[model samples]
Target: MVEQIVEVEAEAVAPIVFWSTENQPERAERTKGIIEGFTAETGIPVELVLVDENNIDSIMAANFAAGTLPDVAFFPLDFAAGWYAEGILDASAASSVVEALDATTFSEGSLALVDTPDGPTAVPSDGWGQFIVYRTDLFEELGLEPPTDFESIRTAAEALEEAGFIGIMSGTDPGQVFTQQTFEHFALANGVSLTDADGNVTLNTPEMVEVLDYYSKLMAEVGPKDTATFWDQSRALYFAGDVGMTVWSPFILDEMAGLRDSVLPSCDECADDPAFIAKNSAFVPAFSGPSGSEAQYGQVSYLGITTGANTEAAQTFVEYWLSDGYLDWLGVAAEGKFPMRRGTTENSTEYIDGWGNLEVGVDRRAPLSDFYSEEVLENIIQGANNIDRWGFTEGQGQLVSAIYSELVIPQAIADIIDGFLTPEDAAVQIQEQVEEIQAALATEE
Candidate 1:
């Protein structure tokens, strides 16, 4: 009787590799927790590997070469298009994942950015919308108010500079983050449109030159000496109290918090604490430009599943991540890292209270409600999707690396800002370089 029973052991499920930037440990940790929870609930054991930002591309490439890419992977928006084009990804399968998204709940712009001709490549996870951050307390102390438009921003910059503070912290690095912050704002302020109705490249237009001129003059007046270096360098100067204002996104808030917690304990110990610094800080919205309206924007990154992922599993993960429960957790873990879904953001008293308490202008603050809404979000998504729809074609990455990153941008920035060349000369050089890149890309195509 004791000798009767036989049992079979369950096979172990393979681990899932997750590639994420170093910028988001909180989101990554939360995601890992969620995956673990899913496995516990369903007995679908999956290990999550957190890849460093530097090694992600190479690792993925090696995996592809070896025919062992992760069962599921999260890719940055910039790299997703190339991955999709290389037959390394299967967009058709990804579409099924998109179909399962809670469309109405997501920001329309965010959703739109991820949509592709082949299908939806990724899910919209977070965004970086530009806002002019100034010192509210400083404004009050200087007997000034928050600037309403570009003219006022200029006036404030001048006043701040005279008062012994650099007016703005701007960087001229060719990386998309720095360039977008500087270029898009300037172009949009001057009404320059980057893409036409049919999505063609319009970088060399007169509007773009005007925008660049405005940017050059503005930077000359208030920007840090080495602005052409990198955004992080500029941010470091700002946080160290070397500058009075800057154009920034939610990441700035996180940086400010870290500074308070680590760098200046006295400032942290003050009654107002973060609120005091934040009060010193105010946010300005995008201004109207000449060719286009001033409210110009662009996309930063997107989250999407790997093409070969299990559709059902990917859907469940995306849905869960976008759900109220997960977003609430994210708000706590990552603070302003990810924008909340519409309903949750609207009804949630916490978000309203948090944003309301900030020193941002009332109008600029009001749009925080619509930040995750369908309309504004859609514009961003569409704009990014249009980048590809326009002239950025296959092999454009290499072209971007060589021309924009390695040559034109660096030369232009140095020429215009460092007095090496005049703005007019720099503009002409930039145009010529762009033309060469376009010609080469056209030939390759």
Candidate 2:
């Protein structure tokens, strides 16, 4: 018989292909470090690539079409569910990884963001809260309560506008998702469930009309006259002390504090204290809407193991991600990272309790515990539990998928605010467009 020598090391070794949409260089460098650590620990190499977040959808779709999909990808929950329906996600493998990681240790609400009717379409990673980041000094100086309601917001905006500053700064670009996200963040509080309990599209309801009217007014009166800016411009405007408030992801925390010099460039005022802008800012997690319930958007993202990937090594990476490698991952941007995996069964709450202690900023290390009160953090965490948007709550991910891909609602909002149509007319037009999108998607399937 021929010599049967088993090469165990060569047989076991497999390189993981990870496509990350972390475009920022500073952040990407830190992420690379974590991957390096993983390689050292596991002896499994990772082929890492930095993808453009703006064009990730097209890139991923093209890769899939060519049968060249990567082993893993950092996918946002916003569009993952729709992809799941196309049988593009490996839910079976992802669900098993979740179970191995200890499901209870992760945030139930965050997991629900990625959960499909079949099961979790992607493995839950980390998430952040969406809320209003406003001027603390201005609010305190004017004796204005938090912008938790429409009336207070209007009052604050008017006062700030008179002081020779923009009252509000939100993304209004017609083509960008920022405007749609801003609209959802604001309307969710107004009780504008874009879809009803049975997953029916209800974008043309009276409540949505009210939401659009208010949004248009805010844009016309308080927002930047340009109405063409998105996150970077809006963030610069706020940190430079030219705007009163902005609605954005919690990722603003570190940038507001001047952690990454590459993005959210430091203002002249920040020369004295790097975290000056962060200290002067006030955060309002969510506001009580007409529905009497304060709703906050939980923008959860996942490290999904792509279908047809090397499942064993992919599973290994995920287990490491949720366990030993987790702290380092969150440490890269601790300011915004709310722990999705709270802890393991051995030490429940361990990760969460340590999360607050994670320091922020480049020159200084200030714990989040010191930055915001425990009560405030608790309230924000509570909001994470109720996180649901139009297509997110019901099994209507397709409706949301269509709404975003087609820019149906964003166009309607732009039309009304830019004087192309009235609120009622815009609503009618959007409804008609959504119907067309549904038909197109159905035909494509």
TM-score for each predicted model, relative to the true structure:
0.76, 0.88
Segments of candidate 2 deviating more than 4 angstroms: 1-12, 262-271, 361-386
Q: Show the lowest summed lDDT stretch of 10 residues, model 2.
A: 1-10
Tens-place lDDT digits, model 2, residues 68-87: 77788776777687667766
In terms of lDDT, which candidate is strongest?
2
> For model 2, which pairs clash?
none
Stretches of candidate 1 off by over 4 Å are 1-11, 22-28, 141-145, 173-180, 195-200, 226-229, 257-260, 263-275, 296-300, 340-407, 438-445
lDDT (10s digit) by residue, model 1, range 1-445: 0111112122375434444453345445556566666666555545456666545667777777777665565555556655665556656655654455445444565555445677656665544455566777677878776765667677788888999988877656544446544565656666554345453445677777766766677777666655455566556666656567776655555445433344331243234553344434556556554444546344435555665566555555555555533443344323233442343434543332333222321112222332233343343333322222122332243344335334465557656776776666666676677767757756764
**Global lDDT of each candidate:** 0.53, 0.75
Which candidate number maximizes TM-score? 2
Candidate 2 Cα RMSD (Å): 5.4
